[model samples]
Every structure is written in C-alpha cells, then in structure tokens.
Target: MNIAKPNSYRSGPDDRGHFGIFGGRFVAETLMPLILDLEKAYTEAKADPAFQAEMNGYLKNYVGRPSPLYFAERLTEHLGGARIYLKREELNHTGSHKVNNVLGQIMLARRMGKKRIIAETGAGQHGVATATLCARFGLECIVYMGAVDVERQQPNVIRMEMLGATVMPVQSGTRTLKDAMNEALRDWVTNVHNTFYCIGTVAGPHPYPTLVRDFQSIIGNETKAQMQEIEGRLPDSLVACIGGGSNAMGLFHPFLDDPSVEIFGVEAAGHGLTQLHAASIAGGRPGVLHGNRTYLLMDADGQIQDAHSISAGLDYPGIGPEHSWLHEVGRVNYLSATDDEALAAFQLLSKLEGIIPALEPAHAIAKVLELAPKRPRDHLMVVNLSGRGDKDVPQVGDILRGKSK
Candidate 1:
C-alpha cells in the first residue's frame, strides 16, 4: 500500500476562495466584514501549531479520530467483483461524520471570542453534533432546521433539545434544508455581533467552503494512512454521498492528488432524475445561493426549485462549490441513486455486513453495488459510511411497511 500522491490536484480556490470560478463571496454587503474577520482568525488559527494540537486532542479524545477502515468481506463475497471496504465514520461519536466539522468550527468559535453559536441542519445530524459540542463548551447554541425535517427526524431534534440547544423549525418554502439555511442566514445577519455561524457543510461563503473542507479533510487523511497500512497501497476508488458535500469532500480532498484513485460522488435521486430528486449536478445549473456560486436546482426563470429525497441529509437543491468546480473540470465522476436503490442497498448492507447505514451514505453504497460487480475482483474500493441508521429506522420502517401493502 504505497501512497501515490499527485501534485496536479492539490491547489484550489485562490485567495478569494474561487474554486475555478465556482466559489466566491456572494453575500450581503453587511456580512462582508464578518466573513473577512472570520477568514483572518481562521488563517491565524491554522498557522498556529497550538491550534492544530488542540483540535487533534479533541478529535482523538472526544469525537474519535481515525475511524476504522474495515473491509466488508461478506459484501465483497456477495458482489464477487471488486473488494469493498467501508470507512466507518458511523462509528464516531454522535453516530456520524458531521461531528468532525462541527468540533473544529466550535473550537474556532471559542477562540474567536464568540459566545453564541448558530447552525443549520437538514437531517439533524449536524444539529445534534453542534448541540453536543456547545454543551461540552458551555456556549449558547441555536440550530435551525426545516419543519419537515423536524418531523421526520424527531429523535435527533429531541437529542439537540436535550443537549440544551434551541431548535427552530422553519416553515417557509419547501420546508426543508434549503429553507432552514435561509432562516439560519437571517439569524446570522441579525445577530452578527455575538453569533458565530457554523455552517454544516462545505457550501457556504468563501472562507466557509475552504474552512469546512480543511477541517473535514481529516477523513481523507485518515483513510489514506489506514488503507496504506492495511493493503500496502491506496484504494483503487472512493465513494461517498453528497448533499452540501462535506463528508464526501472530506474523504475526497486528500485523495484528489492521487490520480490512480478514482473518486465518485453519489447524489440523491429521490424518485428519478426526470421527476423529484436532489441530484444537483445532474439536473442543476450554475447559480448563486447561500453565499456561493455553485450548481443549483433552478427553474427556467432562474428561481430555485424544490429538491426532494428520501434521505433527509442529501435533500438539498445545491452542492458544495468545490464539487461544482470539480464537475466542470472533470476531476471527479458524479453519479446518482434513486430512493428505491438506496433503500435496497441499505437493507442489503444491514443483512450482509451487519452495518445499517444512514440513508445518505446508502446512496454511495448503492453506487458501489453497481460498480463493484463490473470491475475485477482485485480492484479495491472504499465507501464512506458517513453515519448510522439508528435515526432513520423509523422512517425506513414506515416506508417498507407501506411498500408491503
């Protein structure tokens, strides 16, 4: 497992955070100062070895760094083609990879002297993670979630509340992740003085897309080292689901330079691409939203369209700006999985590998199922199991029962 690092894919998003014309600061004039201040603080924090040591200590002692890269022997035998490995992010505290970014952001918030923390969540994983850290640090936490998500992901919502975080449900628009983000932005603009907006994904303004990616890059970094130790080389390919694309980016960023490692990003196709779905790159065009220019679901009149997906986590109308740029540059292959396909993969992994994946990562597993069988048995593939299915069991059960009828 010799590490093959490519230098071609390392550089990105110049000083202005433009990932080749995709990402930039497209925020309100009033927010510019705050964004700049955050960027400067983060730049300094990144340069300080003490900051890195502190974050590393927390990651190891609290959020559980270096999540296992376990080979799914049963699933590999079942597929009988490519060898499959699961990057067990679900094994982390809070049951997801979302904690990786939240912990880093919250640490930065504390360092910035901000007393209040505000965040937006789609499936409640990010909300729960944010709440958990705020409770740990005794910082005020407010999480904004869509009304629909609040109902569908009640367990996580309850967890946030129990952790002493206020959950505000936004009923506007499609009553989903996009609307929740809008409301969260409003809160940030109104309370900029004391509030530090901790974006859940790598899709916010300039510094945010860069900042979140750097924090979450730990996933890719760990995977590289673990795979090298196990197999004596890097994986042949990597796969992960994308909504705002943080987890996928985290796993993909470090491997970007590895030309031999094929990267695949799976987007949620709710029903089908022609109908309701959250396959942003497949069905979207370049547009500006949530402070960055990226591929977005928009109508002919340039109005944002409603996105739908069975997985609450991947039900967004747009993706991370870096993904948008990567798509244009032909750096990574973008694929999609329907709700039915993801559901089937979810059950298959639970039965074969004893791993019940969250619906979000199920999309990636679905893609692996399709590609693994076509490749040679010696081909190595890794899928980022971004979260556990504990929070999705009830929703999946209801859907399964409905299908039985």
Candidate 2:
C-alpha cells in the first residue's frame, strides 16, 4: 500500500540536519567545529560551477557515469511476472556504487585543503574507492577495517594497499564494520586538523548522511531518465539492499514523492530475523551509535549487540537515520532475506542472467524472486545491482564447497 504523498518527501533534515527526530549531530564536542567547517565547505563547493564541472569530468572519464540500466530478460522470464531492470552499478570502476560518493568527497576534501583521507570499510568496496580517489588526487590515505574483515576480504585490503593506502585492522568489539568505524571516529577526533574522514555510508553525523545521499542520488536520477526512455512511463517499483543503506537511499530518494512507485529496502538476515542476523529495523529498537541516533541492535542494558550477515557490507548493527525516518512514516517497505535465500538467488542470477551480483544486492534479488512473480507482467520493477560479486567469490566458494560455514 502506498502512503499518501506529502507535500514533498525530498525536503528533509532541516537546518540542523534532522530528519524528524531521527537524524542530528550527536558527536563529541571536539568534532563539532570540524563538522561545521565541512558543512560550510560543502555548501560553498555545491554552489560553485567549477567544482561540479571537475567532478563531472572525473565521473565520466574515471569512475564511469550512467552505468547501464539493462533489462534482466532471462531473470525476468524465470520469475515470469514483473519486467525487471537491473541498474548496473557493479560495472562501475572499483566495482561498486561507492565510487560515486568518494569522488565527490575527495574533491570537497581538496577544496577544503585537507591533505589526509581516512575511511572505514567492512566489505572493502568503499575502502577501495576512497583509496583510488586519494591516489588520483595525491593525498595520504588510511583505511580502518575490522580484523575479521581484513581476513575475509583480503583481496580488497590488497587493492587498498596497492593504491597506496595504509589499512589498519581494528580488533575490538566484534572486530567488524562497527568496530572499524569506532576506530576511524577516534582518529578523526585526534587528528581533526589535516585529516578528512571520508565516511562510506549514509549513517554518520549531520552533514555526512546528507552529503553521501546527495552524491549517490545519481543512481536514481539516471534510472529515472533511462526508465522513461525504455518504457515511456515511470517504474512501478524500486528495490535495493541496505546495510547502512546508502545504495538504497541513492535509488529511493529521487523517487520518494512519486506515489506510483513502491520502494523496498532489503536487509540481510544472516540466519533469521529471530536468530543471529543483521536486520536492525526488524529485530532492534532506536538507540545511538557512531554519532547518529537511529535504529540499532542492542540488549536489555542498552549495550550494542553484534550483527551477523553473509554479506560483510550488510553486517552493521544500525541503519541510516533517513531510513529510520522513512520506516517510521511508512514511506518505504523494509523486508529481509536469510543467508540461505540470498545464496540461492546468487546462484540463480549467475546461471540465468550471467551476471554475478554482490551478496548485498542478492538479499534484494531473493525478495524479488517472490515479489516479481506476484506482480502483473506489465509492472516495471528496477533493482539496484549495487556491486559485482568478484570480491565475494572466495567466501561463497568456501561455503558452497562445505569448506567453511
């Protein structure tokens, strides 16, 4: 069911960076000035035509803009219902949607005269993008990754190193994405002068959530034009997987006010929502973590709970504040898929469509297996194939071969 359209769902995070009560600057006193400075610089750069032109040049020649919105004919026929189109973000340079935001941030960092770039990553896609951009811009780059992730996503760690980035593995907490972010934040606070924290997702404090979403919105923006060209009408549905929810937000924001479009944000259910899983909105309550107050997985004493997902990128304990706002208002339907289901979809897409999707978007594809078949044949559905599965091949191979669980 569609929620009645508001005056405009696009207007959000009022002057103080709040989306209702969900998003705000919940940072340490020491970082406030830096955050404010970033906001100011981003505002000035946004208004400057030269900044946009420079970023556009790099996006086209470097990261590759307007990645194809191809019809997944084989997969759609296999499902036998809604017409499915895959937004091929996986074809982007560095092999994910992360580069779209990094290019913008790195340019902004240069404008602000910041010489160092630091970031945190779980799946390594974002870290790779940041390192690539820093290397291109001749800036010092450091990436914090969980010790567990550094072990599992070894290929990405190597990629970052080759790009001249120093990768620090955080061993605290669950030794995963959340812990890596914790270390990155501490580094930002201590070295707040020359260091620029290039957040990978849309879950950070204030301007970060806004900044990342704006950069990534190109996905939805391009999809709109491409869909019109292909079908002569707006799409009926949009789907993407959510960890910290940047990719989903990227695809959903541009269409939020379109009541005709039904949006779904799929979260990874590692085992099951009732078991050890990463479906935060499904299994958890509202709380604060990593500078923003949003939905998080926590315990009786309000301590954070560990999250599990087959996809390293979707294994975070919380979601973006804008997602929380959308969830509360019933603007987007949030669904989830188990690891087993995602694995099945992963294999199905590879064989049927010859496209290897990253495990994160596999969660969305798993749901589409059910959702598409039920819709009419004329129903147009677009799914963001957010990244390619090359990085996941090793882990998936081990699981499928019964060498590891």
**What lDDT does each candidate get?**
0.94, 0.94
Off by over 4 Å in 2: 1-5
Model 1 alpha-carbon drift over 4 Å, by segment: 1-7, 403-405
Candidate 2: TM-score?
Answer: 0.98
Clashing residue pairs in candidate 2 (N, C-alpha, C atoms within 3 angstroms): 13-18
Q: For model 1, how does the per-residue alpha-carbon lDDT over 1-405 read when each residue is reduced to its tens digit?
A: 122322466588889989877899999887899999999999999999999999899999898778999999999999999999999999999999999999989989989999999999999999999999999999999999999999999999999999999999999999999999999999999998999999999998989999899999999999999988999998999999999999999999999977899999999999999999999999999999999999999999989999999999999999999998888877799999999999999999999999999999999999999999998988999999999999999899988999531
**Candidate 2 lDDT (Cα, whole model)?**
0.94
| lDDT for 185 (candidate 2) | 97
lDDT of 2 at 170: 96
* Cα displacement (Å) at residue 260, model 1: 0.8
